[model samples]
Target: MTTTAGSRLRALLADGELITAPGVFDGLSAALVARTGFKAGYLTGAGVAVAGYGLPDIGLLTQTEMTERARVVVEALGDVPLIADADTGYGAPMNVVRTLRAYEKAGVAAIQLEDQAFPKKCGHLPDKELISADEFTVKLTAALDARTDPDLLVIARTDARAPLGIDEAIDRANHYAEVGADVIFVEAPENLDEIERIARSVQAPLLINMVQGGLTPDTAPDKLAALGYRIAIHPGALLAPYVLHGLDALGRLGGTMPDVTAGPQGLFELVGLREWSAVGERYRDNTKDGA
Candidate 1:
């Protein structure tokens, strides 16, 4: 029997291996990560906001928009499991029910829901507020109940470290896991000690987000695995590099770069031109003589 993508991810986590997922914004970035042999990929909301809408991660993306982005990345990734960041489930508890179904339909293996209130900000941001634990539990329960496939992992994240402190954040994470969160994410631990505390305290499978230039330290993946994190997602791995080098590339360019500047076929192949061309050739030369 063939194992499904979600099953693959669940098995990877179960086997005691630390799964590292690179954050990808679109189909091309997804394809790149898939080609590079990463076990999983993350569809990050922050990446989607800046890449798709040129905005900040300030609760601006809609549910439909994020689903569409995940759909495309899922197609690009084929059998690779994608852990999608479904920010705050798009609204209240009822909205979380629908949001879960939509993302499942989009073929994501894991869905992450945070405890931040509506109009959520990025996890690394300061002055962040969180909804009451009871309120978040309702949404988390809704997500757990809404999934038809049991293989789909529902990750519950708490952004209360800066606001409520690490101990409270870990408490919330434990409560979320007790309430049906498949994995626990305590976002933005300030130091190594705090990071270690979250790892040692949380009983369930844990996820660590390594945001470039964010609150978390540049702890190595092996270190994180040793610290008891089962899954590590670098959500801005591509976005941060892109912004930094993109500025330099733009400055160096005397004029607007042409379509075919970098690669042999330019940006066309980046969009799968060769594969698409083969598909087009099949139709264009379907003649009697196989022209």
Candidate 2:
């Protein structure tokens, strides 16, 4: 039997190394991450909302929309395991069950669900509300039971640090792990001290979000690994630069955009024109030879 992508991700986690996953919102981003040879890729909900739907990550996108995008990204990523975000599981515990099945079918190696209330905002943003720890635990347990593949990881995130306190966040993270969350993510630790506290307190393998200019002070991956973090997801590493560079190009216009003249053909090559052309040529030659 083929090794499923979820199995691959599980192996990576067990390897005793820090996995760095870059955010990939579109097929092109996924293709680039795969070609660049990353250990894994993250289908960022914020990236999808901003790039795909031209909206913010305030629970505007539905579970099905994210699932459809996840399918396309997984196809583009080929063998790379993708860790996807399914915010708040789209509703209650039963809702989490359906969301889990949908994402698992989309070939996501891992799915992240947070404790934020419905119509959730980005973790970095303020005014975020969360469901009670007990309530979220039920939703998380339901997600775990709903998965068809045992290798498919379920990451439990807590946004309580902002609204309640870091103590609440840590408590909730440990609670989620106790209920069988594969990974614990304490979202938006405000400083190095809070980050260290979370690393010391959380019992399960930990994941840290490295959002640019966000609430969490940016820490190097090596430093994070030293603090006992297992995964560092840079959700804006690509999208932020892409937007800034596009704005610069727009400002330069006909002036200083570095006119490489690499037009449609170059763009197509980035998305695998050569391999597709070879397949077409092989069929054409066989037809000419009357085989």
Residue-level lDDT of model 2, residues 129-248, one tens digit each, is 889999999999999999899999999999999999998899999999999999999999999999999999999999999988788898988899898999999988788778667758
TM-score to true structure, per model: 0.86, 0.86
Model 2 scores a C-alpha lDDT of 0.88
Q: Specify the poorest-scoring 10-residue window by lDDT in model 1.
A: 261-270
lDDT of 1 by residue, 60-169 (tens): 78999999999999999988899999999998899999999999999999999999987787787655778999999999999999989899999999998989888899
Best by lDDT: 2
Angstrom error at residue 282, model 1: 57
Q: Give the TM-score (vs. native) of candidate 1.
A: 0.86
**What residue pairs are clashing in model 1?**
none
Cα deviation of 131, candidate 2, in Å: 0.7
Alpha-carbon lDDT, every model: 0.85, 0.88
Q: Which stretches of candidate 2 lie over 4 Å from their true place?
A: 254-291
The TM-score of candidate 2 is: 0.86
